[model samples]
Target: MTYDTVAETDPAVARALEGERERQNGTLSMIASENHVSEAVMEAQSSELTNNYAEGYPGSRYYGGCRYADEVEQLAIDRAKELWGADHVNVQPHSGSQANMGVYLAVLDPGDKILSLDLTHGGHLSHGHPANFAGQVYDVEQYEVDPETGYLDYEGLRETAEEFDPDVVVSGYSAYPREVDFERIQAAADAVDAYHLADIAHITGLVAAGVHESPVGVADFVTGSTHKTIRAGRGGIIMTSDEYADAIDKAVFPGTQGGPAMHNVAGKAVGFGEALQPEFTEYAEQTVANAKALGERLRSHGLELVSGGTDNHLVLVDLRSSHPDTTGKDVEEALEEAGIVLNANTVPGETRSAFNPSGIRAGTPALTARGFGENACREVADLIVDVIDDPDDEAVVAAVGERVTELTDEYTLYE
Candidate 1:
């Protein structure tokens, strides 16, 4: 037979569920790649679809009894296409890294040249980090941010592309804090006849909500995560123009992955539906506002932010400017002790090592979605700055942590 609700019939499982809920309630999740999905999305993600083993795309599945799976997967595909205006959409890749890998398999050989942004200068590891498969499989060249401005060095990008003549030029970032110049990048890619792949994993929701520029039609390929800013279930999507549809589809299916996660695909459809609403555009705009507010507050307290501040949802604080004696690990630990969470990131030209880099990466999406605004972010900034500047002051840290709980407790996210 079948079991009832795990929480209702199993005492030990119910206790574990309660414990997990408490942990989420007590901690602050400021990780750039994470967010709390809506209840609707969560419901779909936890549905019975998780038990299915539909081994292929909708109509051509390798298994029978895939009627519901077909409907759900196709809905996700159609909604993604409508949302981004893409000629094709594949919601099968399990993560952002997988999406990028599928693109590599689609267009380039193992020894083919690929150019991307450097990790320290705001690029993702999947783009070309030496430790990743991309670097191992291809001829990887990197472009750095402007030494003076700390923004992208488009001129340098052009020069590098012209000289290296990479088959693909990847555009996207993990630590970047400003708007990307997609048009300029398109021109640079055109100059060298390189295919432009825009991995808008972090900014996908913003682009979909119209707060950021859409790369769907402009770039040769666009890849994104379904969770991060989209607040959907965890998965990845690959989209492209009609010309590359067959290549992209083949790359994702037999090339890089097998069956899609039907549970997550259902959740993605709900998220795309939410994104189509006008409210999502407003939410995207508020994320930017909250980030800028937090950035200004941090700067006012003698902390120097990368690029002087942010133009988007992220803030990269170069802690060396304020705590020349402290490292990013020290601050991340201190903040975690004070009920705040964020990642330590590498800053451009940082003299510090990557393990304990000079900067901390924070974002506004999760907090803003929890109903946090500019004033609340200022308070958060003060608490973060206090913890960093006075890590040894246990009393001060405790007080800041208490204040953070008080501020965040007022604004509830999903249960």
Candidate 2:
């Protein structure tokens, strides 16, 4: 992981690189969508394959000198198929958003209707936020989690689908804390003859490890980010039945993106191989356990969790009920000052701006990757509450910062 070669050529960039390394080593990364890939994955991502342009799939390329590229991509595809039990897997979309785009291009024409969860209620932008292309190009309607229960309202979703009759019904979420019932959603899609697209971007690892219910068999198409809980390289994946494989592949290549990032595919291969091991199941389980402990501890402090708790790796805290005056950004900045890093998030029935919303989202994927367990997570939760209670108190922030340093030192990441 040394930058000696880069330092010899570009001292300034090398300094920033080294500084980022030190920063990560010093802080607790509680962002749910983030994780530390193993050195093996990193090395594969940094391989010479970065220079390749294998514009097409394995065994069929648009250019010469793609022998190595084909091998690497095929390995990644095979590993992903095994990991998710997918009939077909495409690890070529540059990002999870692009994977959704590819799926959109494969079936729906512009202006086709889409039904998805509301962003303020845990949906991703690609699912059809007004600012995103999906929203602009498609006719979109939204579903919501029950305000009282803070959980997906399946019956309500069915009602919406029956009325809206969307071309696609999108499942999965960004900040939700509970497990999804994909079958219920699929039934809703079926009632309207719409495609069911389950975007498992945040819980890829949990689904792969059987720690969470998978949407692979229930949904018509499944999409995910490679680097979230899965701890793979940074990329997106699409899984579908053999019926749609050719359409998906063509849609990804000529429809949305061109020339896949072969180095990232290599990284995906290495990371997927790692996930296939028994240790990954333990890691995924620990990730959930740590999140449960973190949520329980936060709830005990009188904080209002979105769904009251978690069945996965993240918990969404709606600050309005408890800390009525505090914005999510206030806690986010204060926590960063104290060396704990997560994100300010939007909650259901949001009354504030998206930038400085009513909630904070915290997760255990990165912390679990750093070897933290429930006890450590509970301790971190206490530190978080301390900062939330008195964000403007410099002395309190300094004290919590000191403890964060100790915890990071004890956990020791990327060494």
Candidate 3:
């Protein structure tokens, strides 16, 4: 898409926009929570609905001239319900973090206890980090994965739930590589008479396509990001039974957020429509397969993966065992220079600071979106290893960059 209209108004911003588009076309995006949406979704997101304020649900907006807005929002809601099978769905919150905040506002009183995973152990800031509003308002305790196995310790979680007697137990994860047993977590929440909020923010599409176990019926509330595995535009979604529908709607509208982003809701409608197609199932399945291929190749090259391998679309590599002196930041920077982009994430039992952590996290959603298969993913893994093995070697970096250029060209994005 040309940015000529934007350039007419602001050349500087237009240039940056074009540069970002070029960068996405050039580099490999392996960030676990990122994806490339279809052009239709982008067009919907850039629609003129951005100027409208639809302050309420369909058929009950507080403003006039909301007929199209109502139609778009209702379509988004219907598609989300069909995708996730929830009795009630809220597609309002601006982001996944806002979705979590809406849930907190819906049920809990100030100072109520929350039990969630530790941030360094694959949890998100919205769950209960000190910097987030949830942490400031709630009494929070954290659980951890097993240090040795790098898997969630369900038995230990049960014990913690019993002892902490939290009001809400938060499941789901940001950087976790394994499939979560939402039923198991719900069982613990049930035993303690606490609510279970499964934040499937990262695996929404995988669950929708049945590649990953769903938390919809199992958990009290299910929240997700539409832009991750779902390949939708940027937005957050919350699903619950009809019993909590009104509470959630009120919390999202008059509680945590103002008017919804109608344009993004339109984008969601388009993206969700696309996901319901038969090919999306193939895409989801291929995403997981490619991740397994990438992880297997990385492990074969002597990198230590958290949990030994992946059950989903992401793999977290703990570098302490394989390269004690090389930090994730070092590898992250070198890999970016070589045109393969991913994030430096903290592993379970972390010994380094959060800024420059001990592990790297990579995923296959965007690559798979660009038609990369298992062999391509393995080759990408090899390139990653080459750079990590010799970050300072100019020749190695140059060679890897050349290969990345070929792959990006071979499986062209935004063409």
Candidate 4:
């Protein structure tokens, strides 16, 4: 991981890269959407394939120097097909947001309707936020979780789908903690003649490892990020039945993106190969176990957990009930100061502004990647509660930061 060449060429950029490496090594990373990839994945991402311009699928590229590009992409696609049991997979999308766009372009007209969950209610912006292209180009309506229970109101969603009669129904979430029943969503979609898209961006590896219920066969289309629970390189993926294979491939290449990021495709191949190993299953189960342990310990300290607890790798904490005066951003900043990094998030019934929301979201994927188990996660939870209780207390922040340093040293990463 040394950057001596970069240091010789551009000291400023090299310093920033080194600083980021140091930050990741020194602190805890609890962001729900983030994970620590192995150095093998990193090397694949930094491979020489970055120069390739493979404008099309395997054996049919528009460019001549695409032999290796086709090989890497085909390997990634084959491995992903094995991992998720999809009939067809496209590994060229630059990000999860673009994967959603590819699906939208493949199926819907310019003004077709989209029915999805509200952004503040755990949905991604790509689902239909007003600022995103999906919102501007498509007619959008939203559903919500049950305010009391903090879980998806599937019955309500069905009712909404029947009334709205959307062209597409987007399921899956960014901040939610409960398991999604893709069958129920598919039933609602079937009732209304709408296509169902399950975006498993946060739980791709969990689903692949059989820790979470998969939506591959149930949902009409599935999309995911390669970097979240999967611990692959940073990229997006789209999976669909063979019936829509041609449509999706065209929509991804000339429709939404240009030449694929072949280097990232190489990384996906390596990471997917790693996921196929037996130890990855243990890693996936440990991720969820650590999350549950963290959530239970936080709840014991009087923090209100969304959906009561987690069924996956993340837990959403609604701070309004436990600490009315504290905002999620306050906790986020204090935790970062204590060397424990996570994010301020929007809760289901959000009363605060989006910038400084009413909840915090934490996950154990990155911690588990660093070899943390349930006991270590529980101790981290205790440290988090200490900071949340007295954010302004410099002594408490310093103590937690010290403990975090010790933990990070014990479970070293990226060495």
lDDT for each residue of candidate 2 in 69-140, tens digit (9 for 90 to 100): 999999999999999999999999999999999999999999999999999999999999999999999999
What would the TM-scores of all predictions be? 0.96, 0.99, 0.99, 0.99
User: Alpha carbon lDDT of residue 185, candidate 1?
Assistant: 95
Off by over 4 Å in 3: none
lDDT of 4 by residue, 1-415 (tens): 9999999999999999999999999999999999999999999999999888889899998999998888899999999999999999999999999999999999999999999999999999999999999999999999999999989999999999999999999999999999999999999999999999999999999999999999999998999999999999899999999999999999999999999999999999999999999999999999999999999999999999999999999999999988999999999999999999999999998999999999999999999999999999999999999999998899999999999999999999986
Worst 10 residues of 1 by lDDT: 1-10
lDDT of predicted model 1: 0.88
- What's the lDDT for residue 243 in model 2? 97
TM-score of 1: 0.96
lDDT of each: 0.88, 0.96, 0.95, 0.96
Task: Give the lDDT of residue 317 in candidate 2.
Answer: 96
Which pairs clash (backbone N, Cα, C closer than 3 Å) in model 2? none
What is the C-alpha lDDT profile of model 3 across 1-415, one tens digit per residue? 7899999999999999999998999999999999999999999999999999999889998999999999999999999999999999999989999999999999999999999999999999999998988899999999999998999999999999999999999999999999999999999999999999999999999999999999998899999999999999799999999999999999999998889999999999999999999999999999999999999999999999999999999999999988999999999999999999999999998999999999999999999999999999999999999999998898999999999999999999985
